[model samples]
Target chain A: MGAKRIGKQTWKPEHPPVIISAAAVVGPFEGQGPFKDYFDHIYTDIMAGERSFEAAEKEMLLNACFTCLNKANRTPQDMDFFLAGDILNQTISSSFSALELRIPFFGIYGACSTSAEGLALAAMLVDGGFASFVLAGTSSHNASAERQYRYPTEYGFSRKPHVQWTVTGAGAALVARDGEGPRITFLTVGKVQDFGIKDPLNLGAAMAPAAVDTMVRHFADTGNGPEYYDLIVTGDLGKFGHSLAVKMAVSNGGFDLSKNYQDCGLMLYDTRKQDVHAGGSGCAASATVTYGYLYRKLMDGELKRVLLVATGALHSPVTCFQGNNIPGIAHAVSLEMI
Target chain B: MARDPKRKPLTVDQKRYTEMVRDLVPRPPYLRNSLLAFLFGGLVAIIGQFFTDIYRITMNMSVKEAGNPAVATMIFIGALLTGLGVFDKIARYAGAGLVVPVTGFANSVVSSALEFKREGLVFGIGSKMFILAGSVITFGVVTAFFVGLIYALFVF
Candidate 1:
């Protein structure tokens, strides 16, 4: 199902104009290991050198925002808010970032789905007659995330291919409401789901069901079928999880997602670049796909209606020890030109 | 004047073009649109309920399955907000809307780090890598510890 935006040129709804001005990626999985060598290269090659993962992440996001605004010919002063987040405590990444922009800030936490959730909130604010000119974003890092979630690198824990590759990078996009840009007409809120899977190591399996659940809900709520949108994209659910999600959706939801399905993690690294057997995290997945694929498609008029689903593995190490598989969840949003 | 080979190639034309383009494009009035995006985003969620129903009735999926679609929808809406350029707008209007929920924080981190990548790897990629995820990781760890602590304190 694909949506074709009608009357896009002159149709500016009460909603503000929203468009992604620019995007960027920074990471270190370029040449780190044999199994996941190339993933580190993105960091080595794209970013240049290494630093504290947290520091690097902060720099990456700050740079992305600056570049995005620069591309749009706007400045931080032009923005009403400085929105940011990360998979960290106290949202240090975003908090620190706020210090840089010195603009009013909002910090959020949605696991990997942070990017999507941020966008949804911002759009709702626009639709509700609230303030405008907001900036929303999300990010992650391999070292920091791994150390926090599991054992530090010194522990030398072996990672399973089924496990998702934690993307040590950040991505950003500038959104504006309703004039001379893509207009977001709708968004579907996600319902949290725990499929009783508790393995933190294998996130795809944990998150697949959640992705299916949210997608099913979105379609049901909209009264739209798979035929309604052109593409259905999921956040970090990589190869295994992506496959599992499709199967679950068809078997459980009675809808086949094979025709129009993609995962951000799957897209982030060329399997050749990184040994990421599955998918990447939220920001890398969101940023790359949004800027790499979706943005281009929007520009080309190749797609009219798109159902983008970002999935997250909401699991804690404590839960894992408690004999829990990763808890998975997903959220949906609709993007239309009209 | 002799140009130093070590000075690196500088493109004045690209800089000039970027400036020209910036001045040429008109920025939107974000105050109004972000609110609309929010409304539209909410409406999308409301509409998603119908999709949830379909999953339940037609497909015999569980409430969880029915609701999964909306998760993706929500994230897409977030991206759309960023695209509309109103995400920044509303972030200014309502702080809670962006921070309290899981989504808003995600965007803040991802968007901020992306901006820093241009400075190059040492300064760009490596430096700005985990800005957003740091929180989730911390929360995951601390929450796990507390959750574990509680289990140990009570169940164990």
Candidate 2:
């Protein structure tokens, strides 16, 4: 199918305007600097002591939320709504982070795609005249995640090379009333795909098909080919999944991925150095690219049009044992600075 | 209460036999532990490709000749290591150690299922089922943008 533009969802600064003033946040777990140096230690502290998930999330989010608000020269109360989520069971990180803001809150669950999803939803609400301004953010913690999801600290199991490093930090973006920056032009909610590969340890290979599906759809929906955007980014498919995604795009979907880059786990981390197995986590993949790469490039005026395709793997052990396949989903949010 | 022996007092040997329970646990030979990892690590690295190949073919399929010597060689190596149980041993030693690259991944799914049998369907099987694969999605997005971002900065 040719790329088809959905409803008129374009937002220019001059039009019934909600401007995106500043996009900033505290982390992304990138540097071996202060945040990384103390990540494991703080994570250990939270995991070892008697603390609720809420408290831990609260501690992490405050640092990031404050950083974002400080950067925007705005306070939490200035935002009409605070949108956020994490890999936690109930999005405790965002919920607790919201406690201090006292702004109307909306908690989201898009896994790693939460960044784009949050931004897209916030944009839509602004464009639709539901609200004037909104702030969106997402964060993830490695220590809290490892214990909650997999084996505990006691059982020392060596990680595989293709594993993703769960990000230890957080990031936030501010969407304001007729501000300056790249505007959200087009967004296509992805169609979920499943390959029936039921191994949690090896994720990249499993998510390739979904990434392919979404990329294909985004192009088809927009009627814009690969040439439209300067870059096409897919959220964490890891190294293995990234390769598979490329192979599928070229060989199966008939699109060349040689030019496209992925934000998978393996691509983000040096497994040998960090024992992350793959690269980084869902939040890390998006957070790093959004802050570390995308925003930076946008600031530099390197390119005007870009497409962010954030992919996610929706699976739980119970579903796998129930003999279910891994369901993959991707959301494409197009960014263009005018 | 005095022990009431059926018929007669139990003899020491009989009592010992009755009280003695055979330990079914496999004892580790210190010698086998060290050398096993190196051997198994190589085997795992080679066989790990089987999972990769299958996944590649299934998702990113290439319609090359199905039955070629190269393919045979790959399968032969996979079977040889799998039969030696070297891959399984590596899995036992290295959590992602074996699973990280490829062959170990299959073992991870199977082993994790074996470990948390009680979480039964959801927690044990379902949760562990596609748990870490999010990394793939995470990286897929990152690299796509990273490449694009880099292209914007340098190449573009």
Candidate 3:
């Protein structure tokens, strides 16, 4: 069997990689969220007994990775590659976890889209026969993200309605050459899109264009309409961005995403009750939802095919403050239960 | 909305998309927010007056002299609430009500101090303590200087 390239950006590998096992570890706040039962482990303390938020993020990622490996009955030495990323500066959470795991690591950075990005790359590696088993993971902490991107956690600054709360959690998945689990069927890499959005607080608006672009491209490449997938989920467009993406998809792409479309941000927390103004946004937003809740759905034969389009705002505080527009990216991975 | 002169001009498609997003995104409830701010701000003022009255009665100080101690007490309470992680939760609902008071200033300073304490005393707590409050202090002093200069020139 030969590997097939579809359309411009989508790829159909000869041998689709199987996600053998996956795990999600969340903080106390996220544990109280709607999808709490799906998560493998929930830390009662946000600090997770770590001295700092950064260390706690790393610990969550490490816990996720180990939980995933333990579920598959695989050890660290069995993994051919460990690809992970985080929203932190230099992706420290992932790199520190890689150091402890002692796996050959590929440190990636896609902001909030990191989980899907890692999954896509890990699938490619397995399909191309470069590796047998790969661990792809990502993590984000609300306090750490707030410290780096916005003001201090305790600051009495009022948030705008569009402002999203960063999720405090980590998610990891084990992709292998052959396994009895969900298979990565199609992958569509996204192009960075900027619509001259400058406000860092309104990341949903900044990121929606890229998500729509990727989804449209995925549909074009696969010749599959929105109805083909039982579920179509975005990474972290929150409420506003998710709506914008739906509108853009219809107006620009000539496709209706009114049905079978949801966002991880909206699924994670009950926005009405939670003080998270818009919704959750971070690397773990899509990650935990897909790996924990959605993965379980697939295993239970609830969903046949699901399209995961993880969106990201590729902007730093320095860049945003420097009067630069925020560019957005999204990667789509079609997962089919096998 | 007036475009920022410093920002690069958007392309036609980009401008159209931006307009679409702006229309689609929900606007903040100004009327409700204003009402909350007004009520909360009045409550804070009432609390300050209570403190001032207590100071006047106990220390035999003039109303003018009691004002400073009352403000200092408010700042102390603000710092305590911030440390307990309660002020931010209130600020979220109170909006400008809590943020436009002396308590907000204390929160700005204390929050930064607590956030950076892990880094150490000099570089973290000391330097970063003014991260948010620095702007307020800077503009406050500058405006005060100009006001003082005008008073000296016109009224003196």
* Highest-lDDT candidate: 3
- Please state the i-RMS of candidate 1: 23.1
TM-score of predicted structure 2: 0.63
lDDT of 3 by residue, A1-338 (tens): 23478898999978889999999999998888999899999999999999999999999999999999999999999999999999999999999999999999999999999988999999999998899999999999999999999999998766678999899999999999998888999999999999988889999999999999999999999999999999999999999998898899998889999989999988999887888888999999999999999999998999989999999999998888768899999999999986
lDDT of candidate 1 over B9-128, digit per residue (tens)? 325633442343234323443554456446644655566677678778998889998777656555555555654556645554443445334445445544544445456768854765
Model 1 per-residue lDDT tens digits across residues A195-273: 5444476666666777877777776665677778888788888777777777678866798888988887776667766
- Which candidate model has the greater TM-score, 1 or 2? 2
- Name the runs in model 2 displaced over 4 angstroms: A1-29, A33-54, A264-267, A270-273, B1-156
Which of candidates 1 and 2 is the stronger one according to DockQ?
2
lDDT by residue (A61-105, candidate 2, tens digit) is: 666666667766888778888998887788888887788788899
Q: What are the RMSDs of all candidates, in order? A: 25.8, 22.9, 2.0
Worst 10 residues of 2 chain A by lDDT: A33-42
Off by over 4 Å in 1: A1-17, A28-50, A154-157, A322-325, B1-156
* lDDT for residue B84 in candidate 3, whole number 0-100: 100
Residue A11, candidate 2: alpha-carbon lDDT:
25
Judged by TM-score relative to the true structure, which candidate is superior, 2 or 3? 3
- Candidate 3, which segments miss by more than 4 Å at Cα? A1-3, B1-7
lDDT of 3 at A315: 98
Relative to the true structure, candidate 1 reaches a TM of 0.61
